[model samples]
Target chain A: MESGQHMLRTGRRGTLFEFSMALRDLVTSYHRRGLAWSLAWHDVVSRYRGSILGPFWITISMGLMVLGIGLLYAKLFGISVAEFMPYVAMGIVFFGLMAGTINEGCDTFVQASSMLSQTSLPMFTFIWRTVLRNLINLAHHAVIIVAVIIFFGLWRVMDVLPALGGLLLTIVNLAWIAMLAAIASARFRDIPQFVMSVMQFAIFMTPVFWKPDAFPDRHAFLTLNPFYHMLTTIRAPLLGQEADGLSYIILAIMAVLGWALTFSVFAITRRRIVHFL
Target chain B: MTDVSIKVTDLTLRFPVYGVDAKSLKKNLARVTVGGRLGASTTGATEVTALSHLNLNLRAGDRLGLIGHNGSGKTTLLRALSGAYEPDEGQIEVRGRIAALLDLSLGIDPSATGVDNIRLRGRIAGMSSKEIEDKMDEIAEFSGLGPFLAMPMKTYSAGMQARLAFAVATAVEADVLLMDEWISVGDADFQKLAHRRLLNLVERAGILVLSSHDAGLLRLYCNKVMRLEGGVASEVKDIRRLDELLAAA
Candidate 1:
């Protein structure tokens, strides 16, 4: 018979234990990758179930926006449409990916409250599902990228390797951001709205439509923006331009720091998360 | 086979009630700007102790029935046992595959069809894809919603939805089963079928914890009865003598 002599107290020690338990749960859930993958696929398929176009709707809209904005904005910025079209196309596609992840991440845990309360599955499973779903959306939007590259004759076989590498790095960074946003939004409840507003503001601020040369004097300030680095790392390679070493360094550092901060907070509050829900 | 057991020692759970305005960032920011004392007075941050210093133990073959009034913490205790709520105080060690039926529609997505929901619910219950696939035909047959299974779940009636949920929940065999109440829905014939299925599932489980207000039902199914009042638990030794026990308490 197991003894119940050891009492479980709700304090700092308990939080530390819960943190370790949460990490274990995360690892175990990863081993059960089928759960996350299927759930993510289910979410995407169900959301657009009855529609004829389904998720291709995203591809169509992105294509139209690229055609319209690429033409109008290229002339406005006095750049050749041939050169500017790919830039804006890649910019919008990648920005949609980044901003969509952040926006959806905020509701990750909150939205799964029903399933979370009923089962003993790991909390990280929901986070992974959110990331996977957004990745699926990104895949749908990538068709537009393919079309733009073909239209603009910007496809380079050699650049494909680096672009994929950059995309993998970006996905790694997104996982941590999603985890952080999900946990925070679950606790605060007001965080999803706050995050959505911030993302809306970030799009204009991050040069998704405008070129960096437009503000030659403020180039230094634009470089400091992490979102700019995030966009450039993947966008540059897809446009057949070399991604600067500085952007890679900045993004790698952000990934490490972001995971560290997210892990610490998640460890302390994993147990209390259910209470908030 | 692993021996199934549950041990809960001095388990306490508290829920913090955040009022409507308290959940808003704008309101909280404004409160912080105003002096701490004034903000504290207006803020409604109170804790409701759902379970208080509750201890329980159950070994294999122990069928424990829980009786409690509204707000008496029966559901809270069930949730804690299912690993849904981490206790604020005390320890809970459960050794078994636990199947918790706290709510019928817990994992059923309204947008999905009945067949799809079975897969989703099975996955949520921690079954591997192979297992879900193996059991799909049986679950479909048990639900008896044959043609309706093709339509979205939102199109199903309440009783039909309940039947699907019950079928999916009881499809897998678990060592420890925690159920909030006896589920009886659908028509007379279907209810009888569901009741028989539930009884078979309860018998096959190593341990069962059920919460319900029907004393007669408890007397029939449970060998041990526990009554919860204000987060405290006490055993009722004899079902026949429950009235005397209640009066004494």
Candidate 2:
């Protein structure tokens, strides 16, 4: 129905207006929570449709990695398996979530090019769908972390509350990261490949397979790595160790900076994105 | 009375071909360091102007037809109206809820069942879950794929998929309806039913913008028509006169 109101307008818009519009699109997508949740579930279910193990395959693979790496590394480092397995499990689980999210985030817009052209939904919807799908995948792999903690008798009720808080913060951080990566990768086709290679290299560089204590002389280098801070925030709490105040400070700074950067990029490129696709 | 209108003023759209220049980081960095002119020439970064300063207007009860040859920006103009492509210059103001059927099966998921695809495609068509749920029975009945609705969409034959997609796409009521081409569905019987349904939808819509190469179909459905060539549009005042011109050509 027409009420002398313009429902859609395409032309020059001020920077602030464009930014607010992009933000409004995000809010609208959130309000349509049903669509996002349904799509996310659809992604996970269809991906593992015919497999007997379904999502459990991720849990099994991760479980084996933790067990195998934990035994060899604990012995190699002169630590008990019980003490090290939980650390390895939590580290790998959280790292998998981080790296997997970034890896998939790059394809969020490119893969949805068809749907985007076919429909006029908010750009944020695709980003949220990617994040939700990765979150679901993380939930599947989390089964291994819980099992390892229980088996090693490393469960601490007091640590659970903070660990959940840290996990929430990490998820929030990754949401911004995903948005930034999705937009950049949409414009430059090779960004996804670059991100994938960087992530593969990051796994060895980050403390996923080893502990920070093992590299005392290179402690400063570890402190400078944002991935290290992201992992530590969730890993320390899960291991029943207190995360240093510096990690929280770094995370808060990163979140603020990341959102600012992502918002600017999204606002500038929101309209031009359709052309790129 | 519900009113629908679309006003486009000097709309233009250009697509950038990100060739060797911007497709890769290495090439882009080298270009930035070495300067733009040399890099641009070597990499062949060029822009394709799909739509020029084209202007048009439509109001309620208007069934406007677009006739154009291939790559003549007919699809580009329709896409611009649907808000799928943003214009590089000028302005477009659209009033009313729009349902664009650019491609019949654009959003259908093969892994999803026929029933599930109805919901997915409905949402993609800008319908709320409740709206889709309310219309589900009618769409299902119209599709005539009762038992097959439970099967995956990939299992459906091409005609079956087309029928399902057409049923869902036209089920929703909108003030503005945009279509790239006339969609024909299923066997002879279903085609008749689909034809009737399409007529009803076009009649109900406050505005309709359809693009096709068929001149006869345009004369039947549209009172006014415009022909596009090389990103420019010119009105064809008399359908008979245009037909004569086409016959001569």
Candidate 3:
């Protein structure tokens, strides 16, 4: 409930005031994170409501994908299944989370258009909803990661901490990207299609299937791909190897720079987003 | 909780009507090379002035009615007052918890049960879990959905859906309640219940801003009335003079 003063003024705001207001909105939405979690859970449950397997079906399909692609690519590359199964399984899972979050982020505002137009609900609520819902899907797909890692007998219990940290960092990075995509796509309807195509092309280019070790000479190009760094933050840690310092450095820089850019755009356009929708 | 107020100074809101051309990147990219004469008509988003330089103030115990012809900014003014739209020129300052019944069906999810939707709406209204739980039965009772509350909302008729939404919306006991129109939902019996419930909600409210076409309804609830003509508002006149104002219009 709004217990204090609420003010809305026209035209440009002082940078400090605008950013402070935007930061306040983020904080307010954070307090309402429970609502977002519930909505995201509802989104997942309701989508698969009457089905027997329900959301588990997503895991099943993802399981099939990792197995199919992991085995096929392992044979094609002449690598042992043990060497490749865990890598591809995790790549698909983590990449799915990243792309799905960014893709669905295109709908952040558009999906909440009804509530946004009629109520004073914080705009960030829907962005978190989109991110959380995709995160839930990632959870379903995580079963594949667990089964693959255990089948290959690949991880130490201590390795779980770093992998969890990597997962958290990856989610933080995707959150800003999703917010930006949602903001842009709310006004430009074609942005979603464009995003979908870009992500599709990105899957092949980001080494989700092929390992970077397979082409050691081209390692410099991998560093240039932000998705590769994001993937490494999670995949490398889970495989019991240290992510290159550059990958974590690049990820930290991306998180900081991406959030800064997203916040600026969001602060300036927060109010006008309704009109765009 | 008692000192509720709303003040708008020279508030103006313009809606940018985005055409398909303006929304499409493909067409815009195509027009970069062929973009000279088309600039004025093709990709430019047409702006419609929804509310222009409107000013209003209401304090505790004030119930103001908004009357206007269709597309004369009635809904737009309510939306701006609700903080759903930003003022394009002026400022809107409000003190109180606001419950805007601008769109009854705005948050209803058909796939969810009626009971679940009440929770969803409650969450949207910024209610905590305990508060929503406490109000759930009361809202369900007021909606008169009874056993149907457990069933998915999709099975309910449009009127039934409206009933659930209205019940949950009005349950908030808002300090400032902004309503688009008098809700007429369900059978004659439910309408009576809804009207009584709304009257009670408005009675407890510190300030009420209702926009409606029904003069009778306005006279019953509002102490003052204002007419909007093409995004411009007339003076806030006393409710007793509504007939004279209507006749003059």
Candidate 4:
């Protein structure tokens, strides 16, 4: 607690040096084990208290959505049932994880305004809870992703390793998004709405329903869209193809930049947080 | 002064409220349309001081009552003492944790069961889950909301809700207990239990600062009284002076 106070006081000076040190301390303190898991479990059980097969409903709905969309999009795109089915199914799973993470990410602190405003604890707990809930949702939906891939004969020796990589990258991406959005949304209050509008445009701009190769001339724009790269990183690798190092580097840079910005903002504005709340 | 366990020196806190600065609608419109300054040579926006150069000291076993009109900085001082708000211009040093009953209703979650909310509030009070579990039966009995303990907190009546919050909050053994007003837990049998519980809790706390306008109650319970007016503490030079002032009035 003394160290926590020191970090806060030094943070108030707003020096870049103090800011980075505080950020390091913040990340290190987040590793205090089991706190996040307990809170997240609390969030899950309390959210669906009365319902039977509560979280299983997540899996059932997702499976039905993929099945319905896979058949419809396969016919609409005039592609073979065999090839198109895998693509659409994988796309829905991958896109769901990406969009759900960012959408929920922006509201992480705002939604937890109730908890944070009352008790003075580590801010990471709120962010971690958001990340954990999404991860839980992913786990439920992953059953669908797995069932579809196995049914379509997409599972292979190399597929296992790439699937792990995809999961890891997705987690890392969501973590970064949560940290960034919490700080931004806490400050602006309008950033969540702005993010929602931007996501609407990003849905069409990214190659979710369509293939990346659909835009032959606008290759640069496709590459610039981080989601395009994230999807490619996860989906391509799972399909037993080479993952893009360029996209990985791009995402790595974005993650670092995002954290840096969040750290500075959080350090500068932490005391003001209660006032806003 | 020798027994002083908490000290506040020249404390000042300024809040910058964000919005148009004008005090009136007509003035705001004039400033917006004509680009005219509302005040003589400066913009209408300025700092509204919530606390200004206030100084006080308190000792262990002191029960102090604060009395003030609305906007008189009673809540701000409480917030500052509890470390909720940082003072801009001076120092406040208290030896132990300050438990403030500023807003009882805000800490509770409507969606959670009474039992669950009790656990959550326990955690907020720095009690580990294991500690809360150990006291679970005691807290349940204290709340007096039998069978409905398993129901959502929103289902409880206002009095029942206050019982749950008060039960959980008092479960913590605090160093200093700050109360804004007297919280009455309103059933006859439970009210007696609550009174005994509150008296015991207040006795255990080393320092108690209560803010209320009821002078007779303050004289009965508090050892000292401090008057605040226009964001400043009234200058009572000594205990004799304070008593003289209170007696003369």
**Top-lDDT candidate index:** 3
Report fnat for all candidates as fractions from 0 to 1.
0.42, 0.56, 0.70, 0.05
Off by over 4 Å in 3: A1-11, B30-43
Clashing pairs in 1: none
| Cα RMSD (angstroms) for every candidate in the order listed | 3.2, 2.8, 2.2, 5.2
Predicted complex 2: CAPRI docking category: medium
What TM-score, computed on C-alpha atoms, does each candidate reach?
A: 0.93, 0.92, 0.95, 0.81
lDDT of 3 by residue, A1-277 (tens): 2332454545445777678768877887887788888788888888897799887887888889988988998999999998799999999889999899999999889988988898767788888999999988887788898897788887553277667777887888999999999988987899999999999999999989998876574377797888898898788878888777777778888899999999999998887799888
Write model 1 residue lDDT over B1-249, tens digit each, in one string. 246788888788887776666677777677778757554456445789988888888877778888878889999888888877777778788877788888888877898999899999888877788888999889899889999999999999988988888788777667777888755457877778876875675566467788887776677667777888988888645466666545655
Q: CAPRI verdict on model 3?
A: medium
Of 1 and 4, which scores higher on lDDT?
A: 1
Q: lDDT, candidate 2, residue B44?
A: 40
State the weakest 10-residue window (summed lDDT) of model 4 chain A.
Answer: A2-11
For model 1, residues A1-277, the per-residue Cα lDDT tens digits are 2111111223235556767776776886787677898899999989998899998998888889999999998888888998888888889999898888888998888889977765667788888898899999988998888888887787753287777777877888888898899987876778888888988989899978988866763377777887888888788877777777888887888899988888888887787777667
lDDT of 2 at A18: 77
A27: Cα error in model 1, Å: 1.5
Question: TM-score of the second chain in each model?
Answer: 0.90, 0.89, 0.92, 0.79
